[model samples]
Target chain A: MSDTLLRLIRHGQEQGCRPHQRYLLDRAQWATLVAALADMPEVALLGLWGDPGQVHAALLIEDGLLIASCGVPDGRFAAFSPVRPGAVLFERMIRDLWGFVAEGGTDQRPWLDHGRWPVTGPLAANPAPNGMAPPQPVFLPVEGEGVHQIPVGPVHAGIIEPGHFRFHVQGETVVRLEARLGYLHKGQIGLMLGKPAPVAARFAARLSGDSTVAHGWAFAQGVEAALGITPSPRALALRALMAELERLHNHLNDWGFLCNDASFAWLHARAGALREAVLRAANTAFGHRLMMDRVVPGGVSDDLRPGGDAAIRAALAMVAAELPALEAVYDSHASLQDRMVGTGVITPALAMLFAAGGVVGRASGRGFDARRRPGYAPYAPAEAAVLTAGDVDARARIRLAEMHRSVALAKGLLESLPPGELLVPLPQRGGEGLGLVEGFRGECLHWVALDDEGLVRAVFPRDPSWLHWPLLEAAIEGNIVADFPLINKSVNASYSGVDL
Target chain B: MQGWRRLLWPRLAQGLVSAPLTDPPPVPPEEVVQALVARLEAAAQTRLGRSLAIRQVDAGSCNGCELEINAMQNVVHDLERFGLRFVASPRHADVLLVTGPLTRNMREALLRTAECMPEPKWVVAAGDCAVDGGSFKDSYAVEGGIDAALPVDLLIPGCPPTPTQLLEGMLALIEAQRAGG
Candidate 1:
């Protein structure tokens, strides 16, 4: 594998300017690039971008660098999933969104386009017309004498997002579990095309409501990178504060939910009250409970209100004081331990193959946290708390550990807050740039390519759920159908993030 | 008995609450509640003595509205104390509380869930996305709002409405149903 297979295709370069590199590879070179990516020790991301008559593949390697291979010049290209299993969903998305056929690809089923779209391949230059009968999606069968199939929702029993799961079972034990998603696809990419970075930031904020701060900051970083602007120190500190706050609230909520699933109603109620306090603090400080659209391109939407830091500190102090008692209850409850332990285990090998991130990846011993890896501001010197128990109990414990760390981080950042301007003016100049952030869920990566007029040419926001969801299918294997909810909560993958 | 006490005492002690478990209701202003009450009174006159049963359906939301809905059951709002409860089935529901912009893939599922509800059932659009599609209005995969698929009786607008707003919206819907509107 010669390094020359991936040649940098430059549009232009200037002195003292960051030159964005887009690699060009011949058809013969596609195999070499795929091999190089597969052979690499760690794979960060696999994304696809399409233009009329051609498609490009972007590979983010572990070294905090992106290698985008273009110039395929046709709809047909070699599939990377054959070499790297993590590329399976990305290839399926490319086929559905771009009308590009992943030649020799596994899993050709429709991903986000679930037969109801007006036309197939909406992003293609000339999309296929409506009324072409949608292909019947095949669920890989588990055949046996007594095996039965159980199909669950696009509409579930509880108040949660919609996704379908089909289980092949013999009696109560699940033989196979297949997830059918994209029930929440709102054509997010299509909504962002041609919009200015400022306008597109709103869409990014709502991409996943729970991870709004993380997604919004990533989008802001993307736009800032493209326009060659850096936010002020104060703004960066504020953003980091908000991100940690978001993480704290979400972790508290999940911990409550996990306890509730394990039949611990007391912890659930206490956690809810604490979570509400955090949200109220956020509302008083930032004007929105979820902090949606508060992080915008160039800087934050607003500065902290008077006494906001105290309010946040008070709320965090309450949570920090209360969580240990709840954890004591969780530890002492024999029944809860029985339910969580040794269930839905994912070995490190499987996690790496699926490229799992966040608590799921950490639980399984893959220590790749984007915040630590790419080393962003504020988190550059911080270390991610990694645990490797590889089970449902480990996942829950990881959330607990992260919640404590996030509280401490928020306190430290607020106490030593930087004094400076909160906003910077971004120039209306365009190029390509990448933004990566460690969201509460895992790594959130957003890539933006802007036209000369500063309008977005394309934007791909790859959520950590894209990689984690496939691992859920594998983790549920051999577990009883009754334990599905408990296992599912442990790996709480976002449906909307991946659906988009 | 000694061993049992040793094992359970610590765990039970940890669950104790030193102060009030929840704060005040954080209720909306009197005028807003009065306006809602007036409408509810008119509706209440028609169906004077019935409680409301809600069946929540998430069409395509980002789970923000779902969070608030779940919060209604918490100690603060304690929705059940007001004679309202979330039922497990649409067959028993008096109102269908829906969230999301009605994604195309979920249109059939939403319609089917709505159809499962008994007659005289009301549909309350829970968030801005369910009301008018919000940020996802221009999306190709979404049909804009719940109105595009079902007859939405009321619209509660917020990116994901606050719990107070949702409570008001539900109260209004209950009154609307009581009035036989």
Candidate 2:
């Protein structure tokens, strides 16, 4: 946390391109590095990169975008998870994918490679690092009489993504909840390695279908940063427009699902109708409902069709007009109020510890919006709405408030639309850069390291879900079993985003 | 309270008395019904019935297909109008609408879901990933497509086929069933 350590590790930006810094550390320095990062106020991410023969441990300090990395001689390194609970899952992932040993880590459970994989530690030198079959996952033991465990799905009755949840309950109250994800892991990072930035952008887009535009924008920004290509003003505005539309539609969808969970069918129906309208508008304007693969490294794939702005304006007006009526319905619905209010509370301390992003963080009194922090174009002057109730109602209200702001922002951006080229050609060069975008869910971060031929040597697109998913475990405690659906809908963390 | 009542009554009334919720069918209803009737008559020759029950298995999708599938049940598409419904259990299903490339972790679950269906059931691969693994074909964790694990009867191609496209695929499968091939 010291300025001296930050100066020692921080690499100066040269010629507008951020270079990846490497600090070759002896065993003593490695220990010092881990201790320094763990003492920081917030550790955004801690991960292991498996280069040809060496393993590098990288930690991203939340403030100033300081990334400190140390290369270890072998795969074994001192773990930071003992001091930082947020790094527990990351360390487990490091063990599962890279076969690296997080010495003295808290937990040893496998993260992504769940033994169903043909080979263990696919990113490591040896396919099967342990030279044996993966051990059966041991669920933490729950003591005390009359406590029972209920295991819910990798596949649920509803049409959703796959993830397993095990709840330890006493009578109707949930004592503890453990979530097991990664059923959707498709080796996305491995697939991105060695591919051109444009090609890898597709994998980033599909990381989570609903947040395609956000992830795609983040990936494009990272690639552009690495290549030192500044997108035209028109492209930046268009990207922001698309991001707000994405946020609007996704928030509407979540609101509908939340209403449905609360047994308010009428409001759910209305929300769904409005959401469909938004998607239709997007299709007319951007040529895809979810806008997949529309955002490339240099710029967007296409510009708004002629009069496309009019269609978006019409849709925005309709949504704005209808939202108040829907909000009235939601306010009048007594059953929904009873179910959502004062349920699934996350304390401010927990939110800060987990570095919760987006609505989850804002609702919990942690005002960390990437748009305002990194202050990128089109949103640099904009303010993100934040609230502090830390309950299901707060989460819902946060989304509602955001939807209103996004409508206003979108209209303003469209009215004052910039004129110029949508893309700038990128020179075939290689460097490393970081991109941070305020996605629908929260801040989506992508770090890219490119080779001399402009091929991606290493890429990590960290979804906000990494911070939010673990918080769900803490939020569900002490709540009754019946409130699980409402609580889960409130968080609505992305499984695919984290699984990848 | 008075203000909310003022706003809610008109919208509720409008919703209740609106015209048909969906846009008019792209194809003439009579012609489509005639074709469907013919297919149903031909399908009667086999053990399969005119109505189809579908159970969707998300092998490893990005949830894009699932969202589209959900859209089909909304007021716009109303897939149930075509005598096709998504059931909760595969035991009651006549068609398996599988999405995504089969991930290693989901392969057994997909197979088990398929096996639960009764005889004369067909599998419809609903996305590009289901057909040939799409962009994630070479992933170490994926088995490529549904064809690698289950017998696919029809392939509906798109990153995710639109709701109407999914409905069309279902109707085509009905025709394929009636053709007795």
Candidate 3:
């Protein structure tokens, strides 16, 4: 793991106007902005082609953000990539959804918006990507030398969601891999337009269930940003608590998978059981295990009830005590160690280039935690728990470490419970909002604009996987094809988050 | 004829046999429907779209669902298949599936197959550490699920949904949409 430098480089601030008083970057600007970011030496990169100009898009965490402008008609401008080796898939999205030209980009065809969608505009002008436009399946080209192609589903043997992966392999060795996603595009962005803030939040959280906190907060950021209201300290603290709780639960499950994949059945089962206990505690405390509907525009929808607090305390103590043994099981099992130790290794240099977050980079020895990166709240109370391993084993270790860290934070939040109004009071109208939550996966940046009546105008939440998806493609390059399952499980990037 | 050890071990079972077990929670979709009719009709959005049964697909997630999915279905507040049934396939499903990293193995199958369901299909990703690869977000073999496939309807936040909470999301979707298709 070498010392490599990669930082977000912003070009400018995009504006998001009134009603939804937020500004965003145009598709062209976003490309230039990322191009500047792509300058990090020794990087593998791709950029997105999102048409927010017609609809007021913004770059909240980086350069500029623009929101609440009119929608752009489909198929208008041609896509341009000022950077060398521009992304072909991005060009596909621009052409298919926005009906723009993607000049000289590879595979310039539909990516997500497969003709079945009822509406196919990017909502730059229409407020929807072609309202409920159904997608017609568009095939992708499989290329390589002496390549025999094998295609595995959108539906799966494990009964998971649908997605197509084409493996262009020579014998058993994979020469090239292409991921075809967005079989599940449901036009939520279109549906959110004109919906009340609270109503829209559900859609946000639903965008990717694992991203509930990020999407909810991102949507809330838009509403609150529109109203120019800040979350109460207590509200912010609670939001942090729930978000971390979500992170801990997710990490525990991932650790369990690592063990399971390596055939450490008992360790896997224990992790699984412990994760369930956390959910049980959540159900006891928040009334919903996943905490859906718990977050609203102003603040959280639920607070710690007296009994619930006690239940959580008990659960935390148990988890904190139980985690060490679980780690021991993972460490002690020789087979588990062998299976995980060096599988799917992502070097520090590569990690820096990709700028990946969560456990992937941490394991690869790149210490980038969103809580630490921009320095957000509650987490500000404590330091970001960063571990640099950069390997499957490293990622697993990070998951174990993060679980312990989550327990400590959960305990701290409970002990320092703040007494205040749960919801912020709001007037009848508009304002701009920007929300950046350190979701379990990593950074979830959301920018929103509201109408005069607090209705949602445009909501754009960027999931951490947006950055990590390509990195996943790179990390698996030299690894044996069979080791892919373990490696893929360890990286766990989100398609829905990136697709949205 | 039994020794004391045998008597103690066998006797313990016989002693415990006096109590009858509570019948298992009704699993038949019909039985669950019959029981939830009231809860659904009462707490349900008086609106037609207020009740929904969302089935989550394991796709390829680590069996984290043994708890999370169970949380959505079991004891404290069991969300029976009532308005939210967990159908095995997409054909009968109204809302779409969940969990993933789409896996080296599951990629193409998950896609061409998910669309077979009737229109107005929606998806819900239920965990942190799930199907868009969760911790496995970087695996090259994984295609990522949920949002990558079809439009996800909602996401139930957590590594797994507490049974009661997942129920809330199903309710919210049904209530908000007021129509499955």
Candidate 4:
């Protein structure tokens, strides 16, 4: 929180289906941004989210953070300017998608999208899919001693999401790294406009399949706020339980991947098995292994039917029994330790600049977790504890720490199962609302607006992945290409979630 | 053909997997069978209650629907018990659950997925994105809703619709067959 002061800065109405006309900073004002950052000691972040196709930028100063994002007429966005050199890319995305010009951004070439798209941006009001093919990617040449540029993905050897990685190497030491994503951009937010909230919430959950609970909860919170509905206390606790379950499950998987990446097969297999067991518990408690349809606005869709608890408890108990052994492997495995210890190191300063959160930030020594900070619902002040270190090892450790924390939360909820309605009815008169859910990733924000007809005016799932993706790109420096997987998994930001 | 092999092999092989505790006779076609009727509607075929084999396409979905879709195939609700299973390839699929709106990047892929599904294929736009491009409508690389690119059989709305609803939608597709698709 250095010069960044964290404050409860109230945000203005988040309009949908349209945005505020424009935010034109005069030359003096543009220069004043650097001055403003220096002047405000309590600014948490200089947040900027831009609509890749729109001409206007959504500029707001919250606490000391200067946020700059672009907006479509619908008030949603294509990409956000997360950190330095973002404006250049934002401008380029705008140019490629909307044919708009960013007044001052220098690098105006295509970023995630190619411009041969005869139609306007992907989410443009009118588009013809049959318009034209996209342009080919241009590879930037590497011209320095020992600085050979090697391009990696857009497609990988394994079954995973798509992304392109360019590494500048000095005989295996990565000097500079570049990542290009958007292969997964499925315009979900724009499609939500005009749809009923329940119908839209399901799409939100898929923003990242891995963080289904968090995304669903965040979207539900926004709709609930719009209708002024609070879930029954029992329902609230259930939501919290499910969220924590998801967190635990995800952490376990990451640990497994981290171990496997380090060639620690025993730990990987054990962790994967444990994760599989946890998912089984999830299926027994909620009807699905991933618990997808369970968390909705007001409350969950399913309750613990008879025999649900015992089965889940059995799985939880087994996981608890295995923790000590799991920790032993984590502590004793030399190769895993070597690969994870100091690789992909994000110093405390850079993590803050990039607004890294969740285990990624926690591992690096930055101590902000929405569950502890903003204090929402069942996770309010009482049960919110965060561990911060700011390193790859610290991140892995924090993930482990969070799993234990999740188990504790689950136990607390089950012991005092509240009896009442699961979900509350949404109020008829809908308005603007925002929800902040502490997902496995971090703060998953859903900014929503409802028309008089109860249709979604606009929905922006400001997933934590957006903030963490840049952090991954930064972390890849000074490491070999092979170590990338473990380091990348350390901050496993979801591409589909953020691209939308 | 594999279809006949898949059909005959299961019933032919049932005795090998079944124990005395789990042997139940298949109902005769003449018995009360609206569920079967629904199947005819679901697949545009005369036979009702045929096991539904679905092929799922990401086509740029956010992955919410994929999770629920995956959940439906798991043990809890056990969609498989209700005669539903997901096939890895589209050649065997009767229903296509498409997520995400058609992105410029994924338009060809999305159309290719739809084309790959055999005739009488039904497309269920699982999330808002597939239904109408969800929240990412106007960006440069996206093409709007999935239906704009393919003929849709049903619109199961949600940011990502719940598993129950998705199950219901698949069931509805079967029912549609009886009702005359």
Q: Against the true structure, whose DockQ is highest?
A: 1
Better of 3 and 4 by lDDT: 4
Quote the RMSD, in angstroms, for model 1.
3.4
Expressed as tens digits, the lDDT of each residue in A211-244 for candidate 2 is 8999999889889888988888888888999999
- The DockQ of each candidate is 0.73, 0.64, 0.08, 0.19
What lDDT does the true structure give each of the candidates? Answer: 0.80, 0.80, 0.59, 0.65
Question: Where is model 1 more than 4 Å wrong at Cα?
Answer: A1-21, A46-60, A133-136, B1-19, B23-50, B175-181
> Each candidate's TM vs. the true structure?
0.92, 0.92, 0.71, 0.71
TM-score of chain A of 1: 0.94
Model 2 pairs in collision: none
Cα displacement (angstroms), candidate 3, residue B161, comes to: 8.3
Which of the predicted structures, 1 or 3, would earn the higher lDDT when compared with the native? Answer: 1
Model 1 over residues B41-102: C-alpha lDDT tens digits?
Answer: 54453452347899999888988888889888877777776678999788888889999999
Better of 1 and 3 by TM-score: 1
Better of 2 and 4 by lDDT: 2
Worst 10 residues of 3 chain A by lDDT: A1-10
User: In model 2, which runs have C-alpha deviations exceeding 4 angstroms?
Assistant: A1-8, A11-27, A37-63, A126-135, B1-18, B26-50, B174-181
Sorted into a CAPRI-style docking class, model 2 comes out as: medium
